[model samples]
Target: MIWNEHIECMDREQIEKLQSQRLCEMVERVYYNVPFYRKKMQVLGLEIGDIKGIEDLHKLPFTTKDDLRENYPFGMFAVPMSQVVRVHASSGTTGLPTVVGYTRNDLSNWSEIVARALYGAGVSKEDRIQNSYGYGLFTGGLGLHGGAEKVGATILPLSGGNTRKQIQSLVDFEPTAISCTPSYLLYLAETLKEEELLDKIKLRVAILGAEPWTENMRKEIEKQLNIKAIDIYGLSEIMGPGVSFECINQCGSHIAEDHFIPEIIDPKTLKPLPRGSEGELVFTTITKEALPLFRYRTKDLSSLIYETCECGRTSVRMTKITGRTDDMLIIRGVNVFPSQIESALLEIGETQPHYMIYVDRVNNLDTLEVWVEVDEKFFSDEIKQLEALTRKITKQIVNIIGISVKVKLVEPKTILRSEGKAKRVVDRRHI
Candidate 1:
């Protein structure tokens, strides 16, 4: 089932050797071709020869989103415009989107990794992949598209939205697999349920990412969709939706270590941490041509597994991302991630999966409220019964995050659903 056994099943020592060689070449590429990185190396008194291998990776400068934005549209591109083949960017909700470029070689490499991801997750030439990820500026749609094409599977380029059309295509094509955000798939599953068409279509595997999801959520998704849900990891900065993926074993996502060296680091100190330690994830692209990055801090929180997988891959795997440091909310001196709240809610199993967190400062103090949707059967219960369920949810969340949150129980299907990344948090506090 391995798409490229040569790289995926390589020995750990051999993988490290290859990474070192690629890292050195990548440093030289960035040092001379991009002045932004050259200035960073010079500031650290680093020369091209100083970086001999991946062992010297810690000695180099780290790249951040600000650095990418500071470079603006094309400042970070290592290759000239004539050589650049394509561009993809972030949503830029806060500022200018971090623009990523690709040469012909880079695009080919991107598609190769994505194809490996799809094939690793049980996709094959015999399968039909209905790509639900949006196409254009974003990387998810096209990233999976190329991967599906490389798999030689029939492609249904049904971009994000249009639930009716997605379900219709599902029924007509009987695609064996799908690719999209996990939250969107959940919404799609609900739609299928409403139409009583769950069993009519044939969907065996799901490739999901672009947002942090808990193990409980994954189980719920699999249960609801009647398909094996696999977690796929990638970011626009790190080559999009195929940076790594879970195999049939589903222990963790196997990283493409040969192309991008992965590291777990203490987010606070910006220092590398030991394997199995939960910390911020960082990556260094060694084979990228258009936009090569050195030690780019991803700000995602996860642990690394270095052992060989049952699927026979020696490449290191990263546990599912717990949360993003950037998405963390600090309330009354306590930091809380929405994923933690989500995990707590799902474990309770009393409320529906749909919920929202509202944070606001009132009367010189910060207030947190959780709007939980009561299960359909419980929504019409007596006030006392509803109050009891509310208390139960409140206690579970308080116990997990050490914060007192007012739990408000609402009716099922009351919360708005999204076909893209779910909007789980609404922070009204102005800081």
Candidate 2:
């Protein structure tokens, strides 16, 4: 089921060699065409000739989201405006949205890589894909749409929201595959159960991404939907949702090394870590034309697995993302991540996957509260049973994160559901 087997299964030595060649050319392009990159290289005393291969990647200046923001729209584009064919942007919730462009070839390459991702997820031309990711400026929807088209699979670009229509299409279209955020999938599962349409649809494989989720969450989705849930990783700053994907083996996601180079570095020291060391994930676009970023810090935390996969792809695999350095929450002098809270909740097996973390300052002291959605069966339990459940969750959080958290066991559907990426954290302290 491997797509583009030649590139996916290329020898490790050959892959590195190809990456070196592409990296050298990309560095040259950015150095000459983009003034921003030229100034960066000059400031670092770096020259195009000095960047000979992948080994010199560390010597180049790192590109951060701030760099993209400073450039704003079209400033970071290496190619002329006439050559650019498409544009996409980040949500820019904190500030100005980071903009990205794509040439005809860049779009084509994106499709090919996305196709590779679908192939890795065991999707093929025979499968009908239901893409629930939102379409407009967000990259997830169109990104998966184009890739599914490239794979010759029939696609129903349902976009996002409209739960009634989504369920109707799932049953009417009878799509064999689905793609969307994991949280959205949970909402869809809930709707399906409400309407008793779970058995009416024929979804076999799910490509979930755009948010960090735990293994317990994945198992829950699979169990509820009766399908295999595969993780697909990407960001708008990079190429979107197909930068890497998990194969059927589910060991780790195989990175598309021929196009982008992956690296893990200590967030504070900014020094590259050895293979299998968990740290910040960084990327360098080797073949990108419109926007070629060098050592772009993704801010995601994950390790790399270089051993050959049983699935037979030599490309390096990235372990499931644990959390983001930027997403880390510091409360009462304790660092915590929403994913940690999620893992603890799902492990207990009594609560649903939907939960929210609220951090606030009370009496000049930081306080953490977790709102968990209890399973329907537990909602009718005795008051003492609910109290005991709350105590159990509080103990688990204390044991795992070393911080006492107030656990509120809310009834099912109490917490709002998201059709796009789930909003799991609300830190009122920032406000």
Clashes of 2: 0
Cα lDDT tens digits for candidate 2, 1-431: 89998999999899999999999999889999889989989998898999888888889888888788788888999989999988987643233557899899989989998999999989999999999988876788999999999999999999977878889899999999999877678778978988898999999999988766779878888999999999999877778889999998899999999989999999999999987899999999999999999899988889999999999999999999887777666454234667778878877878888999998765324579999998886675589888998999998877777657899987779898999988898877542
lDDT (Cα, tens digit) per residue for candidate 1, span 1-431: 99999999999889999999999888888888999989888988999999898889999899887788788889989988999989998733233557999989888988899889988998999999999988887788999998888889899999987888999999999999999877678778878888999999899999987766667768978898788999888988879888999998899999998889999999999999987899999999999999999889988888999999999988999998876767666564344667778877888886667899998766424689999887875565488877888888888888777668999877678898988989888987543
Ten-residue stretch with the least lDDT total in model 1: 89-98
Q: List all candidate RMSDs to the true structure.
A: 12.0, 12.1
The lDDT of model 2 is 0.86
Clashing pairs in 2: none
TM-score of each: 0.78, 0.78
The regions of model 2 sitting more than 4 angstroms off are 328-431
Clashes of each: 0, 0
